[model samples]
Target: MAINTPPIAFGTDAPSSARGKQAGKARRPVPAPRPGLVTAAAAVVGVGLGATLALTITSETSSEFTGPGGVASFAGNLTGMAGSYLALVMVLLVSRIPFVEHVLGLDGLLRWHRRVAPWPISLLVAHAVLITIGYAQTAKTGTWHEVGTLLTRYPDMITAAVGLGLMCLAGVISIRAIRSRLRRETWWTVHLVMYLALAISFAHIIVLGPSFVGHPATQVVWSVAWAASAGLVLCYRVGLPVVRSIRHGLRVVEVRPEGPGVVSIVCSGRNLNRLAVSGGQFFCWRFLTRSHWWQAHPYSLSALPQPPYLRLTVKSVGDHSASLALLRPGTRVAVEGPYGTFTRHAQRHRRALLIAGGIGVTATRALLEDLPRAAQPVVLLRGTRQEDLVLREEVANLVRRRGGKLHELTGTREQQGLDEQSLPALVPDLLDRDIFVCGPEGFVADIVATARALGVPDEVIHYEAFAL
Candidate 1:
């Protein structure tokens, strides 16, 4: 899509008073702590780190170290303990609990989950290697021989090895290059395998882990942490969505084309308002048809939920999404969300600049209908051609009726690409406005970096990438 930033009159140097007046009008009241999602997330990480530290201190002081072998054993034990703690954190992050989603937003939580994921795997790998060497040292056997014996003769090591294999496989598939090459269904299946890996590894920890053996209190704490993490996953990720889907009886009622290859699928259900969805949020939708029922895809709401109805606009970008065009009315649908923070709730200023690239307009269009009325928001829809602009006329009408601005940029990327001066020229008081951006991953990244360079604070620049 065209990515140019038009040089508007506002960008030109104006009277100091005029600039100050506009800036004053753009200023908003201070927002709540939760809007600072990154900081709130850092607090969660800090708490997790603190817990790991306490466990290490308690275990280290309680035990005695005799020699090199003892030191290796202690190191292995520490890695295992940290790995377990991080694994629990990873589960809680992807649980989809309302409290967690409300506080961190799905995008934020997923980002954190990705960051914390490698720690557990890396630590577990270290644990496996170090523990093997420690045991080999004690038994005076070759390391390879010790590993073989540990796997074949130990109580739970065989099963743990299987779990380790699964984890390693999942890790390999999760790399960006490999993951990008896979379909969403394939990627999701690999992640689901992680749950089994964790379950299978649990016995090995309790039965053979040095930190758990002969340490009743520590074992109880670890058990309780694992139990709580599992409970959250069961209650929120599994039970709640199932119950909600049953209660609402959501089904696809219509599918209408928007622009080019884009289609808007409308779902009808009972008490949709109860979902408490915000504009700019998305749902992980599963259309229960022969070909599509096995996977759920995240789609942003294209309009405000009006009782019994929710609308999602999808572009035919992949095999799963392309199948949406063939979906008939009456298809049963399961939804899991109202997830994300690219909404009015994240606005920190009186005036807003909503920028969308290509299909990303689905989110910004939804936000147009519900952003605080006083913000007098302006929307910039960027696309390569008129046909590439999904929901342009509709959003333009909304902006006009709401007394806001809508700018349509249509041309090749070379023609419309934004420059350093272009953004500030288009919106003179951009520094004082809450900026929301949505688009392809690369496009969104470029815009965000430009906004940051132009002085938008990280917190005030709300964004969600449509590509996951």
Candidate 2:
């Protein structure tokens, strides 16, 4: 199964302000529990599983090899080892998906993750069922007191119990129907518990399962995986963020009205002077008033990356953004990075296929300008409800100027969502072309799947998103 990259919904906002101002709403991402926990857990699973396997297959029938006690030792070690390997598979798959910036590019990973949730749960249940059965068999065959001692102190038993229990809870709430019923804040709080589950599961692995307590091979794998994951969390979530914020001290240079509730923020910073980030990437900009630190939000750059002046197109989507209309030019703001690996994969191909839905167009809008339209054939397909198309005219002209094909689908979706549609038939021959997509989560998913059905390999697809 792949890593989950579902979109998140923020609390409702007040009316939007014009460009060059703030919005009435606030935005945030789910906080990693501990700075390095995500990676650290991965390391723990890799080494724990890897070393146990080495010991099990090689354990010779020495004087130590004999009874029910031996049987239980090997069984717990086997299951724990298997469980850890599963965790490792998920972590590595997510890290490898190309162009993960601003969004999950391979919607299949997320779709597959959801689809495979049952398998992990089923494995966990089996682990419990098998162990309990083992205990019952032991108690009947030997002294009950002996069985009690093994059960009470067994290393594998505790970890499997905690890890499996947590997985079950996570699987339960992640279901679509239950997810919709829960408040956003409450749901997040519950999901965060997965961190502890991973830890407890790790604890079970390290303390009980045989092998690697001091072995060099186990130690090396553990250290490497741990360091890598820890480093990522620290860099992207913490260190890089702090540095990006301090160095790129943005001051509002201009706020222009784009519409009734949307404002375009033009800003500049010392770091940005040398940063040189291009279009398609986003920055976390903090308005440096009293509420600035607490008010940081990630917004896409309206201008290309690393510009002397950074610009963002912000929609007044919530209550906190209402003050945006009053934002004074030259107001101080702090910016925390240009995170995400997403960019113009279109550069790799002779032609490009770009898809945008509503504001999702912001994800790839910069790529159109970044590339030479005449040199490479480009096709852009944008989907949105007609009433909400914000920059249709600008996009149309850009597509026209670039010599790219443009397809726009406009209309409202029934409450269920947009009618799932595939790409045009010519899409198959559009091979050798790369695809870039952005928009609502569902919209992006539809387009990416369409591209795949049309024979676009994973390497040729890229995506940026406002959510998920």
Candidate 3:
């Protein structure tokens, strides 16, 4: 991912310089899609379906978790699927979003995705266990009846096997250690297999699951449900890509750094016309020329209000991001987004508390700017070493303009931790104020705990998590 500076060219092609053009063309980079997030998305869809089925078939209920018949479980299933699909649809249509594009940014979504994913896997396991029990309970010989029944049924057996196989594959690769072992291209190829698995599982649900398809109206409803869900997906993914590719020539224009390792990319394409982006959202960026647009990356927008110029603040952490330093000021990159629920509307409290750590300052920075220039009472608590903080200038300006207080900390020094509390000292009414915090995982947790201890109402606490 090193930058390739094309040999300088003169106004006109020199008679003897034809060789350089060919060499430059050959060396030009290509963009590839990032699929880690997408794969995670696919797993989400799989789990949602399995969880829905689990709820439908579960015969028991309890305070902790309800069975299928209970309202809460049903709502959870529906909401899980809808949320995943909505975000997925948004990404497929828009192409780039912060976090999804850069592989880091707005982490709350990813965390929920991770949590929801295991439940679906658990449900699939539960489905298998329950089905086996059902067969064994009915059959005289409980042993081997489950396998025998699966083999005997036509679509039932095949569909379930395919579904389970997909779940297993997704589950095994989901481990970060195992997932990192493969090349990005190889990883995406295997992950896309989830789509086929999803298709198969739908058929299984239609044919076999009792709670899913016992009644005639239920069958119609289920068929329409799958069609509607899949249709929406196709509309965004297939229809949008085709239409946009025809109408838009996707390309990047500039890449610049706002602070430290964070770089902002400005993009222009016909698609910008259809994009009604808002402030406080993110996108999955696939520098179309960067060896992988197929491998999309997620990043948060430093720019708000869907400017004709697109911007993203990226950190140089690893393989994908480490190349930020090499990007030319005029480098071209593909852009996607605007995504995320953390926006101006996301602000609801009279007083807002913004917490930022290291590069996690991006969204909070935008929020600080978008806040009305009023005395709503904002306190920005930035946790970092004296060096390596991003967006200090903008944050300082925001604090100055809004008449809000700002607190800076390198880390916990013994004297400071024991006696000097910056944020609390500056604003004693933390409990009445809304708080937003972002940073590395550990930093986010520590500050969140601090906010709780300081009596910041749980409802007033808002933060954008920046991990996947």
Candidate 4:
């Protein structure tokens, strides 16, 4: 349950002052993000995409365009080349490349990935249909018969067909309505099959595409581009996480309850003081237990690192989160990141307004430790009930120390709404402060929209929403 004052006892057994001292000693400077690097990298990607389109155009001849089914064949070739290149771009977007992730957070990257997704899938489908129709016309055969002939006579047609089928399957399940119905784990497993599809489809492009069939130089360049993208995925998504997990050697030391259905798992690890992570960042945590080792779920740090100790607060929302409470001491843990851009680094003004809804208080509590005393922050904690404000005491203490103000809004949404009028009335100087919000998807969205409607500029509003 929530505690409103320093003297009141909460579930936490350790004194707040002692925890603060430990955190203070463990603080290390995390490297700031370089937006310039991301901008330059994006420019390079655009140039490469343009070059690929040029290569495809230059490879075509005037006679080929005038031949039987030439128009359909040329259009098919163009779409195929563009679609394949875009598919590679889509993979790289979610590859978790450090610089890119730093500039645009994982949420931002995923949003772009979703928007770019439909293009490649649609183009590839069109390419398949056009190519089949073109071949049928040229061979003076029925479309269905041509499909069989291509599969039997062409070198890589069967594998390409399989790859296309897999891509279509992935695309179908990713539709918002369908995705919402599936469990996160199920969707993730199916999405991984796209990599396999891309791998099996590669040979067909170089071997049969008009742009690469007879050109050794173009073929070598194209292969190298694909190879580089694959290497990046392996390095960032696989190799780096493995190395870091081994170096830290973390294991669970305590599981303390904070509220109903919510607990904080404390892990003791080697060289935690050397971990360069900022407050408000999260990691993809993999508990090395038989039931959980196969999947890694993301959770934000509840507080700054306390020397050899690290902690994450989680609510029992799903099977994985519910399982965290049952974890035994000495359970090993592997982590993939200190990823996200919701930290104080994104702050734009001297003063800040921090808002937390429900379990999102975990991030706000940690971030408060990083703010300077002169910041004089104002924190708004919203929960359905007083007991739902999980980390209230610690937040109150932090606010008191920083000469900031704390206000808790505990009630149903209808009773304590945070609309445009209520928001400005609560914080009269809202326009002068940077806004940091963390919460469930709908809560975060509502706050952001309200703030924006009240004239808060986009750059000054930094947020992290908890959702699949």
Best by TM-score: 4
The best-first sequence of candidates by lDDT reads 4, 1, 2, 3
Cα-based lDDT for every prediction? 0.78, 0.56, 0.55, 0.87
Q: Whole-model lDDT for model 1 versus the true structure?
A: 0.78
Candidate of highest lDDT: 4
Between candidates 1 and 4, name the one with more favorable TM-score: 4
lDDT of 1 by residue, 343-387 (tens): 787877898999999999988888877776688878889999999
Q: What is the lDDT of candidate 2?
A: 0.56
Worst 10 residues of 2 by lDDT: 6-15
* Per-candidate total of colliding backbone pairs: 6, 31, 42, 0
Superior candidate under lDDT, 1 versus 4: 4
Deviating ranges (above 4 Å) for candidate 3: 1-113, 129-142, 145-149, 172-192, 208-216, 236-250, 269-274, 328-334, 375-387, 411-420
Candidate 4 Cα deviation (angstroms), residue 368: 1.3
- By TM-score rank, best first, the candidates go 4, 1, 3, 2
Query: In model 4, how large is the Cα lDDT of residue 181?
Result: 99
RMSD of each: 8.9, 10.0, 11.4, 3.7
Better of 2 and 3 by lDDT: 2
- Residues 1-468, model 3: lDDT tens digits: 232232221112112213322221221111223547767866875785565445554622353233332343344334433433332333233232433533333454445555556555555555555555545544534537656766676466677676667866876787789888987567668866656766666666556544444466766765675576667656654565455544545444555555556665555454343454434556666655555546667677664423233456778887677665455444445443445655555455666767677777777776666565663645454544555566666677667767787776566544233122755776677666667777677767777788777766665666666654
lDDT digits (tens) for residues 231-282 of candidate 4: 9999999999999899889988788888989998888787676788887899
